[model samples]
Target: MLLMAITVTGASTLTYFVNDSFISGQLSTASSLDTGTKSVQLLAYDTRDSTTLLQVSNLNNKFGDQKLCGVSCSGGGLTDKIPLNGGTEFIMIKIKNNGINSIFLENIKLNNVVHAWDSQTSGIALNTLQDLSSGGSYPHDGTFSIFSESSIIQSTSNEIPNGNTVNLLIKLGSEDDDILLNKGIKVLLNIGNLNPVEFFIDSGGAQ
Candidate 1:
């Protein structure tokens, strides 16, 4: 006589995300995940482009010096950091299951990492992000922050359900700058099991 092993599964939904902060990340930060009966995980975009790309140099040349004509004056003692001469940029992200394991995605995390405007807008950091399905306000206003890291971002992402995909809308914000090379946005996702799996952010500007 022989015994057989049985497997069980449940229904789940894959969540896509778009994080656009355009801030330079700093310091190493981490957060634990929720370990519920349902298993969940988070994975990075395999081909990169997970975050937004700030076209910093694409400035519109259609403004007159309102303060003083024919003379360059420091506007408000600082250069206006606006993109597309006051236009907008929206980011949409999607994902698919690229692993053998089919699972659920429970939560995403954000650390108090530095952003491009942190110095100017002090206290504006990226924090925790909960599912809209959970029915709660995001960022929780002074609880969890979401930002990218200067180093490679590593987090454990659960296996997305096979043949599952999601279209997530990313918030769009424009910036102005006289400096070169600004950080777009960095998104680090933490799945289940503290999902706490470390994913990698390689060769992609933050969105």
Candidate 2:
């Protein structure tokens, strides 16, 4: 009976030791990963007129695309009532990333809007507000020296890190065709997978 008891105890010990070794090996080979969310916000919209981003009373409405304010949003559209011309009008869009990840400004596409008759073919440029404040050549004043140094933004390189903001200057014009005239200029600013912030500029006339 003593030998039998000793044999049973030894087997139990051996079983536990093997199980512990297996668990340790399994854990050592295991791998894990984590993920985060990407989000962006259109902080403000600036034009020659007195337009601004305002808060909407109801959160359920989805006709407009404005910056989300917690559970609600502001009405989205050009704040100014009067139409604007592409030549003299420059729309400054302020964008920020308030999410857990960074957002890449992938591209700037124009719908029904053509590039203005300027050296900057894209018609979408980086906002030169800071440069203009210090007498930089942002307005392009039809001078050869000023027109040569246009600050057109390149595609797919602009990065807005978390809590960082960027300003985009948009100036696109309508086609000379009568059908396309006054149809309005639509600017689709793409930032990766997120929905593009849209800007609809009513055409006062061609550039």
Candidate 3:
């Protein structure tokens, strides 16, 4: 079997205030080919607006094909619903295999989520990535910390095998309240093996 691995990672920072709502980030992937030339595509969605926020060319193409070995992002689609009134929200990451064969998802890692609400107000939250099969789905555990100032969120690493497609659902919310599903967050994908591959994103958010 062809062994292909894809991993994503990144960080995001958000500020909090009174009556504030909405915070988001993005997850991206960069792909590379080791042997043959392949076509790869990437797709992202906005669960609220049901829109495709990002659509790019090859994620891992070294021959000016606009392809990449993997992709990374800080934040992509930010909605206007994240509660800014000292709360939390959730972001979802969905990935697919637009190629002809199956790809492996080696692992995923999140640094941490830190908050800077104020000079004396701050906190941190940690989360992990769960694997879903081509047709399987999983919900991101909502474990977010909040403050009256600024803060950050971090995560650890998760792993998976090569397959046709994979989906990552991340839940973002504060320990006090539930975050609105408005903003989008960023995640990075580290893909192993350079094969001619193609990826695409499908969602109701598309035009």
Candidate 4:
């Protein structure tokens, strides 16, 4: 007669705390435009058109859900243009301020063509939310720095102090720039019907 036993386990390295857990796209100001309407309503914790963000927390994406970008994680569906063969990269999002008046953000409209903030190249180019510089030197300076070239995202002081959250940062361009392919980031809110919160960029493809 004989007997034996064995056991093994190892897996615990998932620390994504943007408030200790969040997966709900919330964009408001449409309860019939908040009844009686005085026009001055705009809200978004994760908005990208069609009231996106039913649940998102895997880097950045809630409008259509596509993934593939290696460096930041996920690299395969940014249109699948097949050209960027190198652990690809791209990640930027985390703008908050659930609402209650006190969100005067202004500017941010990338009309696609896949990542194009080439202001002559650098760590982060545009879309403003966050900026890093492992090889360029950027630890914190991404509050939407008024980037232009038709992307129009001015920022003297894009306020957002209700729930608080708006460091703003979006990145991409030159991962072997194979013409990138359909990138997006539009959140031009001045409140109310300031209209402009479109986010539809699915070209994470190739890495």
Estimate, for each residue in 1-207, the C-alpha lDDT of model 1 and write its tens digit: 122222211111111111122221211112112322123223232112222223212112223221101012113421222212221212223444444456444433222221121122123322112222233121221112222222112122323454444322222221212111222334433333443433333322232
What is the C-alpha lDDT profile of model 3 across 67-120, one tens digit per residue? 111111112322111212111223334455455554433322222232111111
Clashes of each: 33, 0, 98, 18
- What lDDT does model 4 reach? 0.32
RMSD of each: 19.4, 14.6, 24.7, 20.0
Give the per-residue lDDT digits (tens) of candidate 4, residues 48-106. Answer: 32111223222233223333232232244332111122222333344455556665544
Better of 1 and 2 by lDDT: 2
Better of 1 and 4 by lDDT: 4
Alpha carbon RMSD to native, model 3: 24.7
lDDT of each: 0.26, 0.38, 0.26, 0.32
Worst 10 residues of 1 by lDDT: 65-74
Q: Is candidate 3 or candidate 4 better by lDDT?
A: 4
> For model 2, which pairs clash?
none
Measured against the true structure, the TM-scores of the candidates, in listed sequence, are 0.26, 0.36, 0.27, 0.23
Q: Which stretches of candidate 3 lie over 4 Å from their true place?
A: 1-40, 47-88, 108-166, 173-185, 193-207
Whose TM-score is higher: candidate 1's or candidate 3's? 3
